[model samples]
Target: MSQFAENVSKRLCSLDVFRGMTMFLLIAEAAGFHEHFSTVTEGTVFSGIALQLHHHPWNGLRFWDLIQPFFMFIVGVAMPFSLRKRLAAGNQKKVTLHILRRCALLFCFGGLIALCL
Candidate 1:
């Protein structure tokens, strides 16, 4: 494969892995794993771990709170590589417009989902 293609592929693979890990943590929390641990092992090390897995009560941040930001960071890291690859392939205008539209759609949908939740 071409060098550009290989680099893009590697970058995308790493991004996918990061996203997958983030999603897994989210799903595990949604499944009440942390809550269960906290309830079953209160006043112990497991309780402390469970607390870290959960969000802060209010007006603060926890490790769990970093998940969304980490996902965004991973996306930001991948964006330049993706855009460069597309532009290198000679679809400059089309790729830029498509990226803009995709980002806008994601923003809107994400806001809507947040509101619904």
Candidate 2:
């Protein structure tokens, strides 16, 4: 029942279980497990998941395409927590400055990564 405990609880937790689960599902789906299992059964947990795990044959979205969205969602979730912490620690005046700088940096980083492709 203290301010310190409240602050501690408000800390940004980057290791979210949902994020980890999404990453795991993405990696496993991208590993060709779906194709491997598709040859074996028509009905089963692994098979059904594998069947629904893929994009619609060749082009379109599914649970498979949601992996990137999940990552973006986690980033969005972290932002509020991160900003709250920074602002709470008497960094209010610079919060906007820092967020803008970081967003610009992230944009440039994305561009650089895209250029590599």
Candidate 3:
């Protein structure tokens, strides 16, 4: 293997790839790919697959609904690796502040979205 490939394999590269794929799906959905595809493919064999791109209405889960939780799972999984690297750098103060700032921003944005909804 190449040196770059060897170095990447030593880390959680698969997790990064999974995170990228998850983000790509989210971006595609945001760009209306799912809605447009579903409309165009309606009443065909592909319709069933397209249906999975939308959330189920009140009774159960759908594949689309899982994308968010899967993303969150990826973040949770990656956090420890991040913390380990930061801690190894010996800057606990900066690390703690960064974590706090991230949490605060997430909370603010989440609240704003809920309010908008």
Predictions in order: lDDT: 0.83, 0.75, 0.88
On lDDT, the stronger of 1 and 3 is: 3
The digit string of per-residue lDDT tens for model 1 on 20-103 reads 999989888899877887899898767767777878776567788899899889878987987788888877789979888998
Local accuracy of candidate 2 as per-residue lDDT tens digits, 1-117:
687787675444454778778877777767876677676656766676666676676565566777778888888888777777788886666998887898899999999999999
Candidate 2 RMSD computed on C-alpha atoms after optimal superposition onto the true structure: 4.1
Q: Estimate each model's TM-score.
A: 0.72, 0.63, 0.75
- Candidate 3 local distance difference test against the native: 0.88
Q: Give the TM-score of candidate 2.
A: 0.63
Tens-digit lDDT string for candidate 3 (1-117) = 587787664469789799888988888889999999999999999998898887668557778889979988998898898899989887899999988999999999999999999
Which candidate number maximizes TM-score?
3
Worst 10 residues of 3 by lDDT: 1-10
